[model samples]
Target: MTAITLGHLRDALHAGCASAVARVLDAYEVEVDFVDADADELPGMLDNGEIDLLVSAWLPRDAGFVQHGMRLIGLLYRPVYVWASTKPLGPIDTLTSEQVGRFITVSQDAPRLKAALATLPNLAGTPVETCDEEVLYERVSAAAEAGEALVAMIAQPHALFHTDMLHVLEDAQERLGGEMEARMMVRETVAACADSDMLDELSEMTLGNKVMSALDYTIQVEGVDPEDAAEAWQRGRLVPR
Candidate 1:
């Protein structure tokens, strides 16, 4: 292949991992191009040969895509999901639906989160509003500023950034599921790359909590460009010194 095309969601964690991938490939003298894509769009792009690799979280429901010839190369992170609020909500185990105002979540994650909420005793009957991530955050921030107790389901990394603006519902795992494994997915046509000895060198790579926090701090909080953040992460964290 002239170059390996990698696709990922436009999120901080993947942004860091994309950097890591680029640096690894660079060491191998292979060119790489990173493409930002929606979670739903990744399957189509992989199947249609528009991209070779994808770095994103895959829900259990997404196993069908694997049966359709997609391959899981390796996991990059296992992010804990949490329920964040603007006001004190007490323990997650003791919280009830009445305490939650509007449940804001990302549009891409509505289906999964909605299903989880349906089964959660603490969140039963709580209304859910799915919107673009930026809009979701804005709405949550506004609701909190107004003294409305709002809860949002968010990944641990992104939630950490909002600590000053939101209160994380500790022990949310009591009501939610386990950590989501963010991983690299490749088209079967390129599955051989996953098995190549060259893959081993990069396979051990992972975007841990600390690495993600730094990326978010630099890229989102400090306003660094995603590409530059990736480069710094690749060299400073991923590459052996």
Candidate 2:
């Protein structure tokens, strides 16, 4: 048990993880540090000990953090990059990779999408692969019109359309267990806390709490789950989201 500081992106994912930590470590009087790092810089903060752990939100896309002081505690959600297309894919259950594959661009969302696409026995093709997120969206937008080459992009805006022109070929999140996961970033500094015993006690207190929605938490050792306790804390304590 160590001081669990979180360097986060200020998203639901980050909030969710923080609350879970709070629930487990309340009695130890463990401090919850919130390091406000830009979404892109979160990994850096962990490496720098700016935060104790990144228990809230998505894991990194790159392997740069290998063997760092950080250790993954658990996953909260499956990250997703769904394909919403310009045309309606009728009876989607029968989709083939060739018919809809090209429309589903690949990037970091590949792992989740791959599992979802498996259900569509007929969906297969050379899905346009982009080197980065920006280009992936660009390609999807360009194909907005029929014979228009673009299929769909990673951004939510790509899914928004004036009419039925764009339809979700598949919900990446739904298909991927809400398409999100959480990992804790146990800082080297936090691990060396003078009060390590306090941390361990707190960790035991907050085990198996499902505090994943509405971004809130409450710490209680009075026989309540951590997530629900967190919800209470959010409602009664934390500032507005």
Which candidate achieves the best lDDT against the true structure? 1
lDDT of 1 at 122: 67
Compose the digit string of candidate 2's lDDT tens values, residues 137-219.
34555566445433453423221332344665554335434333344545555567637665454344322222332232122
Give the clashing residue pairs of candidate 1, or none.
Answer: none
Model 2 bad stretches (over 4 Å) = 1-4, 57-67, 74-181, 194-211, 214-229, 233-241
Cα-based lDDT at residue 49, candidate 1: 79
Off by over 4 Å in 1: 11-13, 57-61, 67-69, 119-127, 142-148, 159-164, 170-175, 188-197, 220-222, 235-241
Clash count, one per candidate: 0, 30
Residue 140, candidate 1: alpha-carbon lDDT: 72
